[model samples]
Target: MEKLQSPARDIHPDTRNGLHPVTLLNRNNLTLLDTGTSAEQFLQQKISNNIAQGHQDAFYVADLGDIKQKHWRFMKELPRVKPFYAVKCNSTNEVLQMLATLGTGFDCASMGEIDMVLRMGVPAADIVYANPCKQVSHIKYAAAHGVCKMTFDCEAELFKIAAFHPKAEMILRIATDDRDAWCALSSKYGALVEQCEDLLKTAKNLNIQVIGVSFHTGSGCKNTHSFCKAIEDARKVFEIGKKLGYQMRLLDIGGGFSGNSEFRPTFEEFADVIRQSLNQYFPNNKEVEIISEPGRYYVESAFTVALNIITKKEVYEKGADGNSRRKFSYILNDGVYGTFLDFYLVKEKQKLKPLLGKDFATEQELFPSNLWGPTCTNVDKLVNEFYLPELETGDWVIFPNMGAYSISMSTTFNGFPQPKVYFVLSKGDE
Candidate 1:
């Protein structure tokens, strides 16, 4: 294969320090703050501004600085692995631009995502078409765009790539024991470890270049043993490829790390295990390049969303003791079809509770409340039986860790607009 010649640039200088500083300019006003300012202060001021202006629609405030902190931490731990930000996680312009400027690679799964990344002037070399199963047209598009880095699991995909993008540097995605994962993905993707030999051998027969191996311990994986086992399995595949005259470089440990700190084996613990496993299995680290496709780790906590109660209804039911038991159901501008999708789609039951954005009377009674979305669907409930103080229409409810899978997965199911997003960077809050 010819040497890739994407216009490579130096990583932004801000990355060297603890505070990754970058001026954020977006549709929502950017609040550049001093080192003393905090994310709470930014949210407090923005929520106040929106309320004062009678803005009842739900919206988001993103602390771009938090993303920088995450990036700095990512490099600090597991220094050998490079991050290819999963564009599907939060593909907003502000996010794409900031990460691109920070000099990290991209992991795109579809044609639209590929176009979005490349249109921003990101080099094709800095992209990995990580989706193992792809459309024929999408493969042609990648070939036309010089995106040779991609992945495959089945033999059909290998034949398709050989006929379409023959120069593709393919990564064989192997299956892992993700039974304990929050969202188990092995059932859908990943070729089993026992199947890797046949896949690699078949790739060579098809004149397809199998350059490396990749595996995902599922998103939000719980077992550290699964990670270690997967890495060890990858080493076995590497040996098989070498014997088949294939240079098994590039090991992509797909994202399963949590968006809120760490998934199962805490951040520090997972990092220690991964680092140690890499040392033990692929100790000649200089020979193989390492990369990860992290979606939530970068943006999960960085964005805060505020929603207003558009309407409210209180019902009183006769309890077993013949007492009136009231349950309040309040509707907000956004819901399952809008932003709180995981609840409806995956039944994830996220621990994401709403924080009262405004002060309530100390003596106000708290009741079991049900949150409903503005959509016409009956299943658009944000949470079932949440406790909250009696709130009037227009009262603000804020939620953190709203960045991942919220914006990218939201749809205008009932023609309701997606929440507006504000990007800000505070000098102090890392």
Candidate 2:
């Protein structure tokens, strides 16, 4: 990975606070905001400058202020539910550091994630092993580190936890109505509602402590009723646990919050549904505490990618009516194997805007185009059948809202290197 660096030399008046001013630097060391340009315009200028400086391939811009804004919005809208930032989604050190400084908890799935959080000075109690299936070594590592809060969905997991970490606080994961979710996990995780009691009884028999219930309606869920219905089901399990002489004190509403703005259910809208559901199901309970595992909500919009167009080819093919049709295909430096797996994994079409090009004049014509990555395989295509301004070989494309699964999902396949990441902070960060 190669980073583009420039000498800092510009002072921009701080709109966030009256007392302090921020200095914005472009890739050419140009100061922003002083020229009366909006932030988006400054970003465009930065991208242009970096490409001119021969630093063009693919790079990620991580804005700390955007993360802070998401954190503020989450706290304001869903104050009752404490968020444990899901480590599996974009666990960049900068992101983890920001969340850690903000005093947020973490939901780790593997030993590496837990170790990363712990190395940041977070307490073991603030970490939860949310993956239902556990490796024996991972269980021992969690026990050795004093991170014992975990979730389970079956009897096998109970025995494994009892043998490895007998004192672990177990949360029963129940299946939810994930039919409407973009990436449903009910088939792979979460025990059925009918099996909840038997699972709890088995835990009791094994001397394992069952303390609460957890459920994920699925990733990027747009349905509001899923949460409400899931909460209702969790309440039923709570009653079952109470009848089993177990004290239930925690409710882990696993992640489903969407960060893609163009998609359904804004953060505020999802929070409203969750707020009403919590009020109805677990209202004003002093003994019970509610927490959520949100992965994309904090870092999704904070990231953007700028990629260099490597080549473009114009093609003529026969149409269905026996007429010849013309179209253009573009190959970029990065593709589905690097920072664009979501486009393949979730059918997520990233917002692509031309940043630098010769034919970008106001009256420039648009054409039917297909975008691809610089990989040998045909699966490296990024966009299919999108109308874009006619671009040349040296042009650039910017992808916004790419922080969620891009970095974490990137691979070194086809000998392609991951793009270098550049951090831009709106304010001072410790």
Candidate lDDT (C-alpha), each? 0.81, 0.79
Against the hidden true structure, what lDDT does model 1 obtain? 0.81
lDDT of 2 by residue, 1-430 (tens): 1111111112112333321122443222323222223334345555656655776667776776677777888899989988999999989877787787777899999899999889878899899899999999999999999998999999999999989999999999999999888788998999988999999999999999988999999988878889999999999999999999999999999986877676677878888989999999899768788999999888887787878888989989888999897778999999989888876877752344333322244445556788899989998887776766667787777777888888999998988999877665553222
Query: Weakest 10 consecutive residues, lDDT, candidate 1?
Result: 4-13
Once fitted onto the true fold, the runs of candidate 1 whose alpha carbons sit more than 4 angstroms away are 1-37, 262-264, 361-363
RMSD from true fold, candidate 2: 7.0
Output the number of the lDDT-best candidate: 1
Task: Please provide TM-scores, in order, for all candidate models, with all chains considered together.
Answer: 0.90, 0.88
